[model samples]
Target: MSEDNPHSSRGSASKTWLERIASLFNAEPQDISELEHIISEAANRQLIDEDTKGMLHGVLDVSNMRARDIMIPRSQMATLDIEQSISEILPTLLDNNHSRYPVVNEDKDHIEGILLVKDLLQFAFDAEAPAFHIRDLLRPAVIIPESKRVDALLKEFRQKRYHMAIVVDEYGGVSGLVTIEDILEQIVGEIEDEHDDAEDADIKKMATNVYQVSALTPLDDFNERFNTTFNEEEADTIGGIVLHAFGHMPERGESIELDGLMFKVSKANSRRLLQLQVISGKPPTATEQD
Candidate 1:
């Protein structure tokens, strides 16, 4: 008889338990639906925790999502007017506190180039420095089509070393913008940056039925405060709960109802949920209902 193939046996033994479990089904999932089911099963069997499962799902789904799905809508993008002076631009930059800005001419559609705030540091100390011009400090804008898949764009970003990309429509009109951070958020979750707003913002009751809840509000806290049971194992934040509900990134004005609460995406960008308008339904009572 021939000698045993030790390498083959070693390879089989090296397979992870999860991989072995998956191999019993098939070589690979036929489609996303199957893949989702596999992930669900894995979670149910305690093979992977909910958070890791959710992130793995995100990593898969992000490849199918287009730039428009996650791009910050043009209306929400902070841009610097090319005509504005340093004094005028400083406050705007400070208020928004963004590291980069798309320099524009007369209209937002007319993007000149990107501006890095770090470039302006020189002007802070020397007021008598040569006349400052936005054009002089501009970095070439990386423009991408709205149809571009995030996964492909992420590869391009890594190769090019560009952090931001201007998203354009079919007619070559400026639609919105996407950032490296936005793409990374898909794989690893939110990365708090200098652009983040007040960290202390909390859920506030507006009226009898309506309430404004910050995206950062913990799911447990939300459940306790509202007296509703939205039991979620994967999601910690209200935004994450909503994301899992939709099974994709939801746009502004999109809404979902869960466990007697109506969650409307009141304020959100392509990347993360900012605020949600939650309208409560009747609270549960101890007595049984016929």
Candidate 2:
């Protein structure tokens, strides 16, 4: 019958294969679910890496997430009062180590403008100057609604070249703040700059035996620093080891002995320990104390 068309047979085979693949995929190839599966498959095949996938996922999530979800909570925000003196403002900025801070008057809810820490350097250099008012150095604050999507916020930030925004609730009260860096961090992960505090430093020797140690300090680093043999491959941080030893979350100021060293929880919350004050030497056992 007209020399059995080879092209028609090949076309039929391609259609069948595509239909079978679509059946296995369980969704239309052009749909969002299919796209996610494609990305996962690409990751599995090593065609695209995990980091790339993570960033892609982050970028996608930004469009879906709102300002309230990612904005730093008000409790954690380090704000500057425009009425404060240079001495007070300088120390506060130095302590927090932030580039920009929300300038407020009366209270945190009455935010006036953004303060660039570098602007204070001029006044710091010339303490004898007569007309260096804090209000003069303030940049116009960009206030955004809590419900604003991060994607839209990022676009506005880019268009206006604004780095920070004050997030406000429906009542127009200062809820919190969000930064351009925070939005980018979502897409690319945490951005640790030179000014950022070292999150991975070992036990900082504040004194001879007493030290300020992060709960996240590695067990190996802790052991090597203290010259102890408290080894455990199952745990990474000393906190994890402590948790394993205690079998529960220890409250703040709780002291416990492990591997001959005593650890006192210096900074902790309802959830977990932040920092511990460690002292070398055996603590008194319950039996010995009794």
Which window of 10 residues has the lowest lDDT sum in candidate 2?
A: 281-290
Question: Per-residue lDDT tens digits of candidate 1, residues 37-100?
Answer: 7777788988889997877677776867789877766756779999988888986786566789
Model 2 agreement with the true structure over 216-238: per-residue lDDT tens digits: 78887666666667765868888
- Model 1 residue runs over 4 Å out of place are 1-29, 194-290
lDDT of each: 0.77, 0.73
So what's the TM-score on candidate 2?
0.62
Instruction: Record all residue pairs in model 2 with backbone atoms less than 3 Å apart, i.e. clashing.
Output: none
Candidate 1 has a TM-score of: 0.66
Q: State the lDDT at 90 in candidate 1.
A: 81
Predicted structure with the largest lDDT when compared to the true one:
1
Inter-residue clash pairs, candidate 1: none
